[model samples]
Target: MNGNRFGRLFQLTTYGESHGDAMGVVVSGCPAGVELSTEDIQRDLDRRKPGQSMITTSRGEPDEVRIQSGLQDGYTTGTPLGMLIENKDARSGKYEPFVTAPRPSHGDFTYSAKFGTRNWGGGGRSSARETVNWVAAGAVAKRVLEASDHDVRIKAHVSQIGDVEAPEVTFEEMLEHSEENEVRCAHPETAEEMREVADQHQTAGDSIGGAIYFECRGVPRGLGAPRFDGVPARLAQAMYSIPAVNDFEYGIGREARTTTGGEYNEDWEFDGNGDPTPVGNDHGGVQGGITTGQPIYGEVTWHPPVSIPKSQRTVDWETREEKEIQVVGRHDPVLPPRAVPVVEAMLYCTVLDFMLLGGRINPDRIDDRPGEYDTDYHPRSPENVDD
Candidate 1:
């Protein structure tokens, strides 16, 4: 019930459950007078909504967003932004059998032990269903990020689906080809292969998992906090809250064990203009807990959806007796393709918060608005930057 809030200055707190009438987020601390609309948030929500492709869940959630407040005349009002999404296609009965017998690889058993009860419908608060709020909030964060006086942009792609690796592509290639594939991968050929893998697993009543790669560009240096908010720590903490995320890695992440310091170290030097330049980004984007102003790249790995249609053994909550039940619920055969946006959202919130903390986002105040403050304050807007 607690611990729903995320970020320091750009905080997001969510409410409601998977099978509840609705789930929503309360986004606070967004600067005043930024352009925003339901369509902006809905665009990101559409990507995360269930039933997008054969590889994802078939829940058929309309996921229509309702902006309860925080915007007036298509611009932010500098108040708490309330966004809601109704659960139109929830069929709690599909999970009736799971009420007593928890599903494998699910939060049911653990949730019960921790909270003394579980919603049991689509895994309740622990469900991937909760991520919709993050996506909605991320949409707003995207705006906040854009308002900054920086050229930063965040994007993610499905780098791997099970054992099928997506063909390597340049960042530009990833941007150009990512939307062309149903799997949201950057390479067309590899996306087809990943889809085939998903089909195979779905037909077999099994599941598969993969990793999502993300790239953050144009981030200004000095955004990282020394300890509690270290770049890696903040990113990893946000990612770990996502359901079924198994592992996290950044540049040279988990790949430096065999090399010496000289081999894996990201060299540092000066550019022709005498500005610091990273020779190579073996440290991802952060060096010594701060941004190197390079394209920060990393990945978060997901395990296969635990709620396979096939019967799996579990325990009776009341009696602790072994039980087997077919988890006849809609689920994603592969997660990375759908998770791409989520990675971007988390990064947006993380980076935007740090930026705000560092005074990088200088927003405007509306004139003649009863609560509007000084209207003369203005900082560089990212949209005006030469990316």
Candidate 2:
């Protein structure tokens, strides 16, 4: 309950259960005068919503977003942006079998132990369904960054599904082709392979783990602090917050383990504009805990979804007897495809928070001019001739 909020200056507080009335979020500290609409948030929600394809959950929630507050005309008001998404297809009956038995590798046991009682319906608040709020808030963050002077762009793609891995792709390829396939991998051939893998798992009543590759471009330098507050540290926290995300790594990532220091360390040279630049991007944009004005890229790995049709053993806490449970429900066989947007959203929120903290973008308003009411982003009064 206390950990629902995220970010420092640009904060997001979420509320709701997976099978409850609706999921909602209140985004605070967003600058006023940035153009935003429910459609903008809905676009990202559509990507993360359940029942997207054969590989994803079969639940039929529309995930349509409703903007409840914090806007005047069509722009943000610098107040808490309240948004809501109702759950239309929540079938709590499917989860009743595990209410006391608890599913394997799930938070069911821990939640019950900690809270004494829980919603116990669709995993309650621990569900990835909660990320709907994140994608909503991240849409706002993305719009804020776009409307600002910074040209920050965040993109993520499904890089691996089970044992099938995609070939390395450029940012341009991600933009052009990631969404073209159901797997959301940038490489079309690999995406087909990933899809086939997911289908195999789905047919077997099992689930598979996968990884997502994310990149953030146009993020300014000096947007992060040292040690605990490093950009990489915060990003890791963001990525790990997503359910099932077991691993996070940036820069050369695991490759740095075997790489020699001489080969891993990037040499600095003057750019054509005379600014110091690294000859290569093995560091993935951050050096010494601060951004180096280069692209920040990384991968987030998720464990297989615990909820599957396969029978798993667990104990019924009340009966004190063992039980065999089939977590049969609408569930995704692979996670990376749906997770791509979530990764991008978290990156947008994290990057925008650092931008505001670093004074690279205005915290109060996108225009950066305080007490000046008559800006282009603001609504204009009706002309006198309108009478």
Candidate 3:
């Protein structure tokens, strides 16, 4: 499709469908000589893969990633990094009925209206399964950022599910506890409550909406431009691109609505190192569309998944009759728990893109040294082999 690509400088173009043979991504513009491996990419994929817990989808796909190109001796080659993940567990029999009937609140109707036909199996290209490729690409971006001179860290956790909300926590707390539970919430007590609520919804054959809290630390200042290319604007595009994400807010977000300028505006001061800094972070690390050299914190709200086991009515375009259908296929009862990794992946890609665009990182190589080919990561000629 036309919109599969994302980012500038460091670009990601994804291909394949949910029920197709495989899902793949091409990550272009990655600098050479960065250490990368199938294990590095698979770690993130396992987090985003289905069947991780009782709250997520039960699909048994292992989500094993195969690196097809763009590496030499475990380092990137500064070319398109091609990776593939097979869809071994995609069951299409359950989706056949919806080909003509169209699932309510799904892309089925819209895709058909626009494209005149679609691969109705497992919602085809419009499925959340498409995000698998995004996580794969983000893994590559994560490695790139890790190899850079800057220390960039990105993390996200389930902040709310239905009515259960986690208390505000420190970045350290999020790092320490977010991945310890199946719900992926930073607070243990709140995570239990969220799990209970998710169970209730699943028992009722319904779904519930939730929110994710994300933070980006160590992003240098002056990485974004004003107006259309602003940091917040680009972040919104990235966060909203994830399916089911209904809203995005950064830096005190909606609370600014009732806040006076005096109460909301952060005063500037000099840090111990004689560097200008904001006294408070009400702007969520962006001031006037550029980064403020502080932690970028925000929340993204997700609508309940449209698919459910509960009966729903839809009109069959071909039969000219209303049909009641129950989405009995495997699906998630709640999304944020598994979405944590996906959110982090996207944040990694976005931050690295800004770094490259701002000239903070080298576009050709992580070492930032041009016209020099003999590097430690480069392979050596075989010592004893004779041609």
Candidate 4:
């Protein structure tokens, strides 16, 4: 019920549940006078909306974003911006069985243990549906950041599905090709293979896991605040909030553990003015928690959809008796495609927050002008923050 809010200066709070009347968000601290409207936010929601393709859940919610406050004349008013998306596709009948028999790999049991009861319909707050609000709020943050002359961009694609691996593609190719398929994979050949894999699992009444890679470009040389607010830490925290996400790592994350120290260390280069730039971008753009003006990259592993039609065994929370459970509901056979925009929004929100934390970006001053960013936020001291 608590802790749904994120960010320091430009913050947001999400409310409602998956099967509730609606799910919505209240975004605060955004500078007024920026060009915005329901369309700007709806564009991202359309990408995140469920039932968009055969790969995602069959639930067809319009995912229409309604801006109720904080804007006048198509601009922010510097007040809390509230928006809502109704849940038209919710069906509680399928979840009736889960009232007593908790679904494995889901928060049903933990939620019951922590709270006396839960909204069993569609996993409630624990559902991936909760991420819709994030996508919406992050769209707002992205717009605010764009107005400041900062061109932070996030790209995510399905890197792996079960055992299938997508071939490496350039960021430009990814932008062009990822959305062309239901799998949202950068590689056309591998996306076909991934679809075949998902179909195989669905036919067998099982689910498959996949890995998603996100690349952040155009981030400043220094952002991320230090102590507990490192970029990687915040990235992990935001991503972990999504259901079915089991693992995360940055560039050379586990790979570095296998290499020797000298092999893993990134060599440095100097600009004409003696500024440091790594000869190789092996660090993924961060050193000591601060960005180094290189691309920031990382990956998140998404566990297969937990609510398969196959029957599974679980203990009854009420009677503590073992029983069979069949998870039946509107769910995605593969969720990677729908998750891409959400990932992009979150990365933008994180980097934009760090940018504000490092300097004073008056929301009121941001506009359509280019190269108008206030440089006071660029971190001059590496020790102050983590990238």
What RMSD, rounded to one decimal, does every model reach? 6.5, 3.3, 2.7, 8.2
- TM-score against native, each model: 0.92, 0.95, 0.95, 0.92
lDDT of each residue in 1-387, candidate 4, tens digit only: 678888887787899888999999998878876778788999999999887766677898999989999988787778899999898988988888788788888888889888889998888988889888999998998888767767777889999999999877899988999989888899999999999998888778778889899898888887776757878788888788776788988877788877897887877789777998887877788888778888999888888888888978988767879998778777787667788888888887787777877773665545554334556675767866787
lDDT of 1 by residue, 1-387 (tens): 788999888899998889999999999888887778899999999988898887788898988999999898888888999999999988888888777777887778788888888787878888889999999999999987665557788888988988999766778887898888889999889989988998999999999989888889888888887887789999999999888899999887888787798887766799788998989888888888888887789888999888788877888867878877788878888778888888889999998888888878753332323445657655566654666
Which one wins on lDDT? 3
Residue 266's lDDT within candidate 3 is: 81
**Clashes in model 2: which pairs?**
none
Residues 33-107, model 3: lDDT tens digits: 898999999999998999988899999999999999999888898988999999999899999899899888999
Ranking by TM-score: 3, 2, 1, 4
Q: List pairs with backbone clashes in candidate 3.
A: none
On a 0 to 1 TM-score scale, where does candidate 1 land against the true structure? Answer: 0.92
True lDDT of residue 319, candidate 4? 88
* Model 2 TM-score relative to the real fold: 0.95
Runs in model 4 with CA error above 4 Å? Answer: 272-274, 367-387
Per-residue lDDT over 271-334 for candidate 2, one digit per residue giving the tens place of the 0 to 100 score? 8989999999999999989999999999999999888888778999899999887887788888
> Which 10 residues in a row give candidate 3 its minimum summed lDDT?
376-385
Q: Count the backbone clashes (under 3 Å) in each candidate.
A: 1, 0, 0, 8
